[model samples]
Target: MTAPHTGGCRCGAVRFEASAEPHHISYCHCGDCRRASGAPVSAFVGFMADQIALDGKSLKTFENGPVTRSFCGVCGSPIAYVDERLADQIYFMLGAMDMPAYFRPTLHAHVREQLPFLHMPDDLPRHLKTSVPRPSSSNPDGTQS
Candidate 1:
């Protein structure tokens, strides 16, 4: 998907605009993500934090370990996820986007935690854990060096 993507919460209490193409896009089958989103799997569209602008008075955040997730307090719509390991990027929940069909996930993460009943017959690359690499000065692109 291209730039200027827009989206909001179910109640329209929170909204966001991303000014650039996503840096990463993937489907996560981790238990945490499943539980948080109340779905068997969750998809995210990642972008540099600076490339997105959020507007909401009902936005709330929850921090767990090195990750912080944000949602709309009014409707409990999951918004974004930020991991300290990838401090420069923010992953927005694909379901919260206005045109979710436009964003195609390139990979599957936490496959080991996927539900046995969920059968996604896709050829996308699968990872036992997260596919995102920790970013550092030597790995500015968040890729393994």
Candidate 2:
């Protein structure tokens, strides 16, 4: 867990505040991630859903495989991901945070599809195509956007 958090999308329509810490912070570099963020990887921060307080308007979402992706309809900025089985937590976009600087990616998952030029530390485990991430690359790695 980190510090208290606050964030929203590109559009101001959807917003929220969390007076809790974050867990399972990492960057995912997979085909789905590339498509969602149009980058080598997608940086995400996970949080317990009950701690969040939404404001203004509701968000729209699409099913991207196992993740329920939420985003602001007005601005189209990706909001969060709700696990189908565990609705208590949400994976939110790191870029959507009001104070995003505090977070840094620990490792890059789904390394099988990482862009050739996208340089990241290789000391971390590189999963081939599929893996249920544990916190660290070793025994088990384990969260966020």
Candidate 3:
């Protein structure tokens, strides 16, 4: 694996580099992840927090309990998600990576919450929910006022 992999927000306002390879990569289908990314599924690469370096100070964070999601303040592009319970790691938003192809999702999480219109065409393992409980949601995605 490469010593350093680089990526940034869509508008390039928030840049970062990860020195270590990810511990795991997967597609998160939880409602919180979907809403945060504005996508059907959110792909992420998890790594030790100490291995990543943020190039700028343009990161704005939103918290849901112990989990904090970071995004580019200028462009609203999701950057990373940190679960305080898992303090040693950071989940980098895969779409924000300069070389997304380098990271392949190995499984699917929160499969029960996946949108009806979405489908997983691959044979990756699917979990009814993630190993850790996601923020529970009684409302549908994008429907809350």
Candidate 4:
């Protein structure tokens, strides 16, 4: 595995260190993700929550359906997305990483909601929703496959 990954908010108010390597890196085209990052799509890397140590009293969260998004209260930089159903993992926005290029997304999720004006230049698999193995619970992002 590579060296420990470290990152923080834009204002340096929030910081985190992850020992374990991430899995299921993805480009999410879901509306919630777009809204959260103010981008047509958002790239994220998922790691076990226990593998990370987060700091910053300014970190705040917004629970959206089954996911809670954490960010820096001062800079409002989107930090991570905690999925309630997947209690063991946390999804950190790829762009927030100090070494964002280290993580390479392998798939696209929520493609059904992708905007017509947006397009990606990759041949990775695209799923209507999550590509991560998930319980058959109703998908909070949209319809289940």
Best by lDDT: 1
The number of residue pairs in model 2 that clash at the backbone is: 14
Candidate order by lDDT, decreasing, is 1, 4, 3, 2
How much lDDT does candidate 1 score? 0.91
- Candidate 4 — which residues are off by over 4 angstroms? 136-145
Cα lDDT of model 3 overall?
A: 0.86
Among residues 3 or more apart in sequence or in different chains, the pairs in candidate 4 whose N, CA or C atoms overlap within 3 Å are none
Q: When superposed on Cα atoms, how far off is each prediction in RMSD? A: 3.4, 5.1, 6.3, 3.0
- Candidate 4 — worst ten consecutive residues by lDDT sum? 136-145
lDDT of 1 by residue, 38-63 (tens): 99999999999999899999999999
Better of 1 and 3 by lDDT: 1
RMSD of 1: 3.4
TM per candidate? 0.91, 0.78, 0.88, 0.91
Model 2: C-alpha RMSD to truth?
5.1
Checking candidate 1 for backbone clashes, the offending pairs are none
lDDT of each: 0.91, 0.73, 0.86, 0.88
Alpha-carbon shift of residue 73 in model 4 (angstroms): 0.3
- Number of clashes in model 1? 0
- Please say which candidate is ahead in lDDT: 2 or 3: 3
